[model samples]
Target chain A: MEKKIYKPTDIDIERLSALARISLSDTEKESFSCDIATMATYVSSLLSDVSAEHEREARSLDELREDTPVECDCARDILALSPSLKEDHVAVPLVVGKDKEGDA
Target chain B: MNELIFRSLDEHKRALTAREYSSEELTRAYLERIEEKEPSINSFVSLCQDRAIDAAKESDERRRNGAPLSALDGIPYAAKDNIAVAGLPLRCGSRILEGYISPFDATVISRLKSSGCVLLGKTNLDEFAMGTDTETSANGRTKNPLDENRVTGGSSGGSAAAVAAYEAPFTLGSDTGGSVRQPAAFCGIVGLRPTYSALSRYGLVGFSPSLDTIGILSRSASECADIMNATVGADSRDATSRPFPASDLRALIGKDVRGMRIGVVREAIGEGLSEEVLEAMQVATDTLRSLGAKMTEISLPHLHAAYAVYYAFSSAEAASNLSRFDGVRYGYRAESCGSIEELYERSRAEGFGDEVKRRVLFGNFALSGENREKIYGRAVAMRKQIIAELSSVLSRCDLLLLPTASTHAYRAGVKKSALYCKDDLLCTLAALAGLPALSLPYHRDGKLPVGIQLMGPAFSEDRLFSVAHLLESALDRRESAK
Candidate 1:
């Protein structure tokens, strides 16, 4: 298989920054140039072998599970683990910005 | 007889079912032994007295009522601390999770409990399951039970040590590369890493989601097989959990391997293999040949790149899996952090051990935005090639037999040459291939034990176990005569 060449444009950096969940300074970005491009090239290779031809559309991660009975005990555990649970619902701080897509 | 502790797990189960021993009596004896021998070995991070006694009482009650859960219902088992057991501290041998408790039991633990197995407690492991030696554990290094100055092979060192110390009959461990089998070999026990996806990964604190599998350590291959049979199946909660057709497999002991082809991977048996280890492999094959198994040599071209591939993928997975430890919701968050960032860095920096931080840094470097392709990406591709090469070779062979690890257990923190230091990777090919592999105790060179690794096609665990059982019997007979 011929390798794909990738250039890390500003948008690619933005995506990677979100993926890594670490803020990058300008010098950090400059240092990361070759690495970002390299990783993108590799990801594209794995994507090539995925054979998306079998599926008409890719479903979201949460939608991947089949319709099945949800165990009450499991749900209880989730609620018990949540820090800000109020009447069986988890409370979370309002986000400063929306999350990047396709991160999962 | 303490001989029961050394017997095959299957035999003990059968004997227990035949009214030979009550579950209560067995649990009591093991508990007493753990109390006596566990201090020096440091095999367990936590001991589940209440849970074990409760289960034992219930088991005795069931027996008195003329009903039994299963032959293994009352069997006591230990779990590596990396695996979660509800209400028990799931400390991954790191200070970060020192006081952390799991909200739910790991799938394997839950399955064993459902089958009436008693939870002995959580065994020790390397911190966050990062190091090859268990010495990096925050809870102190687990000393080899056989030779205290020598180390128990790790990061599943405690799981192996527990079985060796007879603190528990069997234990569950995770095998990413050779964590389970390497330690088992050192501890002179049987460790089975079932084919990838055989058991669910849910509730396991140890990361490396793609490569990690729940493995079993037992005194005998049949005992390992029994646990595998109970734990291997599909779980809707686990996205990668695959079904293993276990019911149809016969537990063949001393079965003939007439016309069966066995390949010894040249890459797996390389330079620096100890004289004892090399001799053990030769003797094992000679015995297998006498049992009618044909042997040949096979080469995996990508085997040289297999370790690199494993580190890349395993670390990348590690980087992602460990991101949850920000001290936000639970676990050991920083106590005196001035701010959120301080809390995050200090909690991790202070809580994690030196080896863990080093690997995480390395993993972060590989998985970082700039270098992901050169390291993690190349490694993934290499992983595929290794698996493909392994698959193609398996079409011509019924099994592959080789050394489990290049050499026997080393003394604590004794570093070998660069080539020899990393020789553990030689035996991890079957792990990377996602094939079912068995490490059976073959011989002990008076320093520590060496294991004979038997690898078979993916999902061919029963057949692999059958061969291992035969070999184990032959070795055991020889040992007894000696």
Candidate 2:
């Protein structure tokens, strides 16, 4: 199997760096750019000898579970463990909820 | 407390049933043990003190009323952090959900609760069950009880360490690849990855859903079989839950191996195997042969790709499964974001562990439109080929022989092997096939024990257990002779 190196774009960097929440200097970004590319190359071997039909479903098994059995206990527990909890939930400083779609 | 922690779950259950130890006493014993040992061993992430004591007190009440539910009643068992316990932080050994607790119990947890089992605590694991070594946990690394400086074998390393250290009689671990079996081998305990759908995945934070199965680690395979007997079967909550028939997990316990067909995969005994491991495997094969079992040599060239396929498929799926933790709905949220994308980037970057980020970034790259065909698709095809080849091999024989690992216990403090160490290693290949594999510990050799793995066709857990039990007994006899 032939291997191709996929370098992380600036947008990819912006996306992941923000997601990871770590301040990466330009030097770190430069290194990470190389590291991420190498890592992608390493995982790219998964591309070899794998069947296309098998992955028709990207995540493989389509395990869509019902959103029922609203668990109040787990939330209470997490809230309880939170360095700080309020209004019956673990309250972080603030969060901007993303639109449900396109995230996947 | 340490002594109590070391006893098997069956022993604890017997004591509880006989009133030799009150539920409160047993719970207290484990709690104390955790306090003393966990600091050094680093086994648990969360210990639900009030909840565990309350459950123990309730079990005490039931015992007092002469109405205890089952043998497992009042016994304490730890869950791998990846598996949720209602109201406990399912940190998954990662910072992403450091304080995030699910609102419901994992299906296995729920079943265990209904059976009257006490939650000892939650054990440490690889960050999101990604690595084979537990060093990447956000909290801290879980040390192997047997060898403190060495890895405890991960994803399920914490659970295995707990069982090995006697922190808990039995513990729950998720096996995606060799998470359960590898640790079991490292810790010298019995670990069983039951048939693919035998256990429900309702509450297990998915690593690789298709290959992930909730495995049980215990002092003996029998203990694991009992737990499996209790937990296996369909669950309404998990769509993939298979219809497992209710029968004694060890029903074929005494099935003589007089005429059973067993084939040892010649390809499995390649270079990466250690001398000790080779000798141990030879003993197991010899014992089965001596017992009148017809053993044969088989080939599985496709297995060479199990690691490749496993990494590709599992990592790709992981990138998707973890997308839900993006700071918005639940979990850790990093503040001071200008845009939604910033919120996601910062939240994830801050919340997830380095290993998780590595998986996600790598997984994303693999599944991206351009590389999807080149990598993820090809790995899937390889997996399909491997599975089909395994099925064909199964057709030739009833069971396949496996040397749990290609090496013996790598002693603590050793820098990574600077050699060809991939082949015949890790529990991923059998796992990728979603087949039932059992790792049974042979006798201890100067405190380091070895194990042989047995892999059976899909849904052949019953058959696998039967063979395993026989081997265990025979191995026990061999140990006594020594």
- Per-prediction share of native contacts kept: 0.00, 0.35
* Chain A TM-score values for every predicted structure, listed in order: 0.44, 0.52
**Residue B430 alpha-carbon offset, candidate 1, angstroms:** 2.1
**Per-residue lDDT of candidate 1, residues B1-482 (tens digit):** 35456555666677778868877778877888888888799999999898799898898788778787766888888999998888899889888786778767778888888788998888999888776668888899998998888878887999999999888889999888878888888888899888888888887775687778889898888778778877879888788898877673445444668878999888767586887678778888888899888999998765655565666667577767776876775577767768766677666656666555434544676666645654565555566667768888899888888788777778887741112235666656877877888888865434467888888988888788788877875655344436
Candidate number with greatest DockQ:
2
Q: What residue runs in model 2 are displaced by over 4 Å at the alpha carbon?
A: A1-104, B409-426, B473-482
Give the best candidate by TM-score. Answer: 2
Residue-level lDDT for B239 in candidate 2: 86
Model 1 chain B weakest lDDT span, ten residues long: B415-424
* Candidate 2 local lDDT, B6-79, one digit each (tens): 66677787888889888888888888888888889998888998999999999999999999887778988899
* Model 2 / residue A94 / CA error / Å: 20
Model 1 residue runs over 4 Å out of place are: A1-104, B1-8, B248-255, B415-421, B444-447, B477-482
> Candidate 2 chain A, which ten residues in sequence have the lowest lDDT sum?
A95-104
